[model samples]
Target: MQKTRPILAWETLLDIARTDAPAPLRERVEHALRRAIDDGHLVPGSALPPSRTLAENLGVSRWVITEAYGQLVAEGVLDARAGSVTRVAAPTLSERMPPPHPPSDHPAPTATPVDARFDLRPGLPDLRATPRARWGSAVKAALSSIADRDLAAAHPGGYAPARQAVSDYLGRSRHVATTADRVVITHGASDGMSILARELRRQGHRAILVEDPSWPRLRDIAQTHGLRTIPIPVDDDGIDVEALAAASVRTGARVALLTPAHQFPVGAALSPARREQVIAWAHAVDGLIIEDDYDAEFRYDRRPIAALQRLAPDRVALIGSLSKSVSPALGLGWMVLPHGLNPEHSPAMPSLIDQAALAHFLVRGDLERHLRAARSRFRRRRAALLDALRAELPDASISGIAAGMHLLLELPAGADAAELARRGRDHGLALTPLRRYEDVSRRPEALVLGYGNLDDTLVSAATAALATLLRARSETPVASVRSERTLTG
Candidate 1:
């Protein structure tokens, strides 16, 4: 009797080939085959189907299969004799090493549940709404128009055209008074912050002031670059300029980072008097202010506030990115440095192609058009969430709804925002407690509800679920409520 060969499933390879991935046919086939082997779906000595057979199954030409198999054989992932069936290669020394395991006392980690029906986490836009066709066209146009020398190397600041485009857009839209010479393109706001932090440290700055409940990533970046962070309190009028000035004097810090247009997590724009005070403080201390102009494009109630940089361009280093107005996946941002500061030796810059594409996108006015549409969509979503929250939790304090993508929801006293958030996750709702953004110990009594990425259909349901959690907490015994530090919202 003849020995029977094991049959491997071809459906996985077929599915991969049929997907819309941009890789070439041969590369895709090689990737699929390599994955199968690494996953142990095709064990050592397992026979692979003939090239002709797999080609027919995957609806690709035989050459693609042959090329992929030859490459795998060269990589030692497979073995093939002159006329014999190709088989998965035996495990090499590195591959034979035992898989890493957690400590005996610790349990193995499991993947986080991501099937949440509603995701209200802040700092994300509707990724599904990305204008793929327009971006592709922009990229194509950029590729065709860019000179050969421009591709050879990128300027440390940025391509001239990209810088000019960004400068023009900021001047017109955000009222940032800057020229292309002052613009330095960065990977994103985080990258810009990192660069600024390093520069501040180099300028003999030992400490920097930040908003108490501001975005934590920027503070972390400053700390990483050897600057001690001094937390300054923020109120309805935005960062307490008095506290900032006192801290700067006490710490001898000459740099302060702020989110003035729309404060993070709390959504307070800097009051006009406070803005002037901040600029005066910068001048009095001869300090620099790093303005984080994030998510200021989608203001709903009225026209967007002019950028704080406009007031004192000489003292403020304005950083803005496409993360909110567009998708963060693009990894594009810009910094308008004060006259004396230069980012020639700053950290990594964005890709040349991406910068060119953005220039084209801006020149064609696609960015403004996109922002207009995004504002309309976000307005509707924000209104829906506000209406739902108002109707369900009338006693709860809601603020920061005047602008930005997220609003602060302060749960009534005795209700645990953290506990409510945990319960929310179990019911397919995502919640972020306000304490997550604070460096100091604070009560977890507030949640930041981000409606930018939430779907229209799920707004009502998400709010209802949150209300149920809050109601349940309220019904619990007073003895169950634990004392915690005070939180600012």
Candidate 2:
């Protein structure tokens, strides 16, 4: 059964959010973390997020979150004053042991440090800046409007109002037309992929064709469910379609996932013509295309491009979420399947089964309204973040500044991205390393700095620190005299 993949937004605190989130958000995320800890989802005494890194990951300026972490420290929930490391306090929840999270059969929970800065970690967006009041109002409205009976068990596909909102949001915002009935709301894009993986596997689907430097997690999720992933290299125009076709034929992998618009870290947009060719390939091979729209909302240079889902809704599974546009902590994202998909089944349609828990949640949920509010707030915050990036990184020569919460800097070769991140963290600053996303062993040196969560002041500080770091590096022996051979080539 295919579960509609909803997206997950992981932020530590919303309690002290000066602007982005509210107490409930903070409480919920923190509560989840606490439960995960006590329940073993997060190991006991696992390295907790350095408040500063938590701030960066959530799109909040670091100081506010730093203070919040101090509170947790004071409350004995976390260890404070642990420079550069945020360690979870020993579990104090023994009073009434909470229910254990069912052990995941997939024992692989990727061990990601909550405090990783200069993250450049793929599949995430700066989400600490979404407008709280707006979302609160939406949630209130959705809840008030719900019928007592509506809260009873319903379709696992998703709730109608939220599904309609998503369908509308995609159609209007992304130029992809679809009815709410076709939308499946899972926990996040990850959940959607799992469902897709499961369904395809059940029907004998064996392999997935993917971009070589594509999101590692997608392949992880795919392989977790027994699908062989084929690597297809990407160039400036997005995935090498010809290469993908060749790989598909060579490997007999019929399903392929793509980030055509703002293709992951390199920020390549698939040309319109190439998108058409991809559609043709899918149709010709009876294959499926998973269009992962990782970051389409914050293009700075020009208008946002329409989604590939628009060109061929029947063949493309459009994956979108508010993580980048707003806050990942909200855990709101959606999957739009082609009208060809099932249980709306037909030969032309691909039938998908829904998960039971997801079905139960929607029957009694207010998620749809929250998504609407989140999208609206995120759009506004994205603009603000962009302005901050431009003002702060004046000397860095930022490109792909067109959209998204983050931008890239073309740094000198051999620049140590991890070192730069470390130095930033040492001084109350946080950032993502370009090496985290690219083929570090081979890709050019760069940095993926985020502007979404921080206010102008912090953004400026981060940039200023970055400038100093780069300057110091330039003055160093290694940078001042690059091997003549390194430059000649």
Tens digits of lDDT, candidate 2, 70-98:
66667776654533355566555673476
Error of 2 at 140 (Å): 1.8
Candidate 2 off by > 4 Å: 1-128, 343-398, 439-441, 474-489
Candidates' C-alpha lDDT:
0.83, 0.62
Compute each candidate's TM-score over C-alphas: 0.79, 0.64
Output the worst ten-in-a-row residue range by lDDT, candidate 1: 480-489
Instruction: Provide the lowest-lDDT 10-residue window in model 2.
Output: 480-489
RMSD of 2: 16.8
> Model 1: what TM-score?
0.79
